[model samples]
Every structure is written in C-alpha cells, then in structure tokens.
Target: MDAAVAEAHVAALQGEDAHAAEPFRMSAVKFAMWLFLASEVMFFAGLLGSYLVLRFSHANQFSEEALALNWPLATLNTVVLIGSSLTMALAVSAAQAGQAPRTARFLGFTFVLGVVFLVVKAIEYSTKIHHGIVPSMSLFYASYFTMTGCHALHLIGGLVPVTVVGLRALRGRVDGGKVELVGLYWHFVDLVWIFLFPLLYLI
Candidate 1:
C-alpha cells in the first residue's frame, strides 16, 4: 500500500509539471510587445499634451507657423504609409498561411513604401531648412520636428525587424507570431502619423 501511494504521488507531480510546462495562451514576445507599446502610448500622450498646451497659449503664432508646413507633401506621405500598413497586413496573413515566398514579397513591398515615406519627409525637412525654418526658430517648429522625428526613428527601428523577418521568410522560415508582432509595431507607427498629419498640417 505504501509503494502504491508513492507511485500515485509521483504521477500527480508529473502531471503538475506538465501543466506548468504548457505554453502561455498569449506568447511571451507578444505580451512584451504590448507592454512596450503601452509605454509608448503614454510617452506620445505626454508630447501631444505638452504641444496642445503650448499651441493654445500661442494660438496665432502656431497658426502662422503651421502655414510653413507642406500639407500636400505630408498627405502624399500619409498615403504611402497607409499603403505600407496594408502590405504589412498581407505579409502577416501570408506568414500565418505558411506562404513564405508570398510573405517575403509583401514584406518587400512594405519596406519600399516605408522608404518612400522617409524620402519625402527628408525632402520636406530640406525645404524647411532652406527657408530657415527649424526647431529653434519657433515653438511650433520645435514640436513639429520633435514629434515627427521620433516617429521617423520608430519607423527606422521597425524596418530592421521587418528586414530580418523577410530574410528568414525568404529562407522558408516564416514565423507568423514574429510577423504579427512586427505588424503591431508598424501599424502603431502609421497610426501616430495619421494623428500627427492632421494635427500639424490640417488643424
């Protein structure tokens, strides 16, 4: 009877161990990404809040300075970013479907669109600089450069992961989870620009 009890106890422990070893319902990497994004949301909220305070206090100055921004160019860049988001979605779908080549193709498209966005932004920056419009020139220009520069940096950081995942996909090693995580980040970056474009250019 003692031997039988020992065997049953060992079985119970083994079952518990197996249960503990099961994967999380949500992946660890995905959870980490969500946490990171949450922090980013708070960071941007602070920036926008500060900008709004300054903008309202200096309404006429802001309105006058906003005119210097090239809304048409910004609008074009918005469309390009939106297109990149669509391609990123397609890449995620392809990865989920285990279509590695298709995933790579879509990732390449997304990368190109992202590059186009940066190039247009660079042109806008050059024009502003040529006209002596810079961050130190005014509060409005300072906010504009700070917000857009941070967003651009995020996009540049995201491209590295996209390229890595795309290369792996090309080698028939597509990870849907990684692709989805990257998509989450890319979409967030695009969404920020969506808010920023209208706020700085149209508003």
Candidate 2:
C-alpha cells in the first residue's frame, strides 16, 4: 500500500497520472535523484579539471611543500566509509528479510560512522588551518582548499538526510528504500573522496 501511495504521490507531482493512470514505475522521486546525481558528477568533473590544471601549473614551485596530509588517518576513514556502505547494504538486506530491528541496527551504525567521519574531517581541516594555508595564500593551496572545501560542504549536506533517515529508522518508521536512496548518495560522496584523497594529499 505504501508503494502504491508513493507511486501515486510521485505521479501526481510529475503530472504523469494525468496523461495515463498507468502501471507502477520507479517514480518521480527516484528519477529526480538520478538527475541530481548526474548534475553532481558534472560539477565534480569541472572542479577536478581545475585542480589538475593548477597542479601542473605549479609542479615546479611548491610540489614538495604539500601539507603531507595524514595519509594513515585518511586511509582509516576510507575504511570506515566503506564499512558504512556495507552496513547500509545490510540494512537493506534486513529490511528485505522483514527484520526491522536488524535494519535499524545497521542503519544506526552507518549514521554513527558518518559522524565519526565528520569528526576526523574536523581534525584534518584544523591542521590545515593551523599551518596558515588559507585558500588566498597561494595558487596551489587556493585551488586545493576551494575544491576540497566544496566537497566537504556537499558531504555535510549528504549527512543531514542520512541523519534524518537514521532517526526515522530508530523509530521503525523509515522505509527500506529510503535508507537505500540516502545510502546511494552517501556512497557516492565517499567514492568522490576516494579520488580526491590521492589527488589532493598523496599525488
């Protein structure tokens, strides 16, 4: 019944039902999500292109002076993120199996992992600020901070929805696909960091 209601709600919003009160579909909500993610991919592509141009332009100047970010800590955070993705997957599986308690358990764990990720990021950003490498300082750090800071802000945005979904799950009110939908976005953010980590810190 919820699926039917979800479909009806989406079709009404998209005016699809007016054309044809037809069979069920992925719904407008899911379609909009795909559109949003596609736009995000393009956005990141532009930022990456800018970063690469700056990197080559400054190779001979400050190449050796990289803040030498805490590689081990970043690597650990990567593991944590990947683990959260797996836990999110498990939440979906438990929901499919009709196990609300287990689903909530996994979802709650993933949310806590997100919080841990933010805390680690705070430490990382604090270190960068401590060394006086503001974005206006140099061309290299300028682009680095701008690109990475934008990514961080998106990550925070992703966390907000995930936190809300987690709270709903705790009360057994959240749908499985809601968890899956938010998880999809959360995982994409993690995947972006997988690329940005090496580009900004290691390379």
Candidate 3:
C-alpha cells in the first residue's frame, strides 16, 4: 500500500509538470529590429544633443552658416520624404491585404522617392562645396554635415532592404510581416529627416 501511494504521488507530479504553461515568446526578427531601433534612437539623441550645444555656443556663426543652406530645396525634399512615407504605408497595407502587385507598386514608388531624396541631398552638398563651405569652414558647417551625413547614410541603408522586399513582393514571395518590418525602419529614417530638416535648414 505504501509503495502504491508513493507511485500515485509521483504520477500526479508528472502530470502537473506536463500540463504547465509555456514561457512567453516574441518573434526573433521583431525583437531584434526593435532593439536595433532603440540603440539607434540613443545614438541619434546623442548627436542631436551635441548639435544643440554647439548651436547655442556659436549662435552668430550658426545663423551665418544657415544662410548658405537652401531652405526651399530642403522643403521640397521634405515633401518628397513625406510622400515616401505615404507610399511605404500603402505598401504595408497592401501586403497585409495579400495584394502582391499593389504592394510591389507602392514599394517601387517608395524606392523612387528615396532615390529622389538622396539626389536632392547630393545636389545640396555639391552647391555647398562649390561655394567652399566645407565642414572645416565652421563649427556650424561641421554640425550640419555630421548630422545630415549620418542621416543620409541611414536612409541609404534602409533602401537596400526596401529593394529586396519590393522585388520579393513583385514575385509574390513577400509576407505582410516582412513588409511591416521594413516599413518600421523606413518610417524611422523618414522621421529622422523630418527632425533634421527643420533643425539644420529652417531653424
């Protein structure tokens, strides 16, 4: 009888263990992307903080350098980036809806807009360089180039994934989650530009 009671208790414990709930889990890709973006946010925050400090220390120089920037052209680029964000959102929507062709079309639009932004930015840089307004010219110019250059690099990095996913979408081999992940990254890039344009150009 004692042996049988011990065996029954062991069986009950085993059953409880077998029925236990599993630990929570998140998608590895999503978790990684969010972590990456968080680190990027801190990095950009540091850059913007340093820029503000420099701007305050050399107010007059900043104002003088601001004159060299073409706000009108930057405004146009702002519009272009904003348009790209719209297209990216549409691509995500279409992808979620399982509309492969529509997703591809929107993604193509987004890629073109991104290229236009880079081209316009290159033109701006060329104009500045033509006037001998290099980064070594002033603290303001250094800050301007550093911030905008970092931003451009991020945008360029985002474009690669956008191209890959867009091509896959065209082939009907893309998933909504993949497009959504790219959209999150692309939106972050666009948002960084939105902050940068007003700070480095208008203000």
User: Which is the better candidate, 1 or 2, if ranked by lDDT?
Assistant: 1
Ranking by TM-score: 1, 3, 2
What TM-score does prediction 3 earn? 0.86
**Candidate 1 local lDDT, 68-176, one digit each (tens):** 6899999999999999999999999999999999999999999999999999999999998999888998899999999999999999998999999999999999999
Please report, as a residue range, the 10-residue window in candidate 1 with the lowest summed lDDT.
16-25
Q: Which ten residues in a row have the lowest lDDT in candidate 2?
A: 16-25
Q: TM-scores of all models?
A: 0.87, 0.80, 0.86
Model 2 residue 15 CA deviation (Å) reads 28
Which regions of candidate 2 are displaced past 4 Å? Answer: 1-25
**Each model's Cα RMSD:** 5.6, 7.8, 6.4
- Tens digit of per-residue lDDT, candidate 3, span 64-142: 7787699999999999999999999999999999999999999999999999999999999999899998999888998
Question: How does each model score on lDDT?
Answer: 0.92, 0.77, 0.91
lDDT, candidate 2, at 28: 75
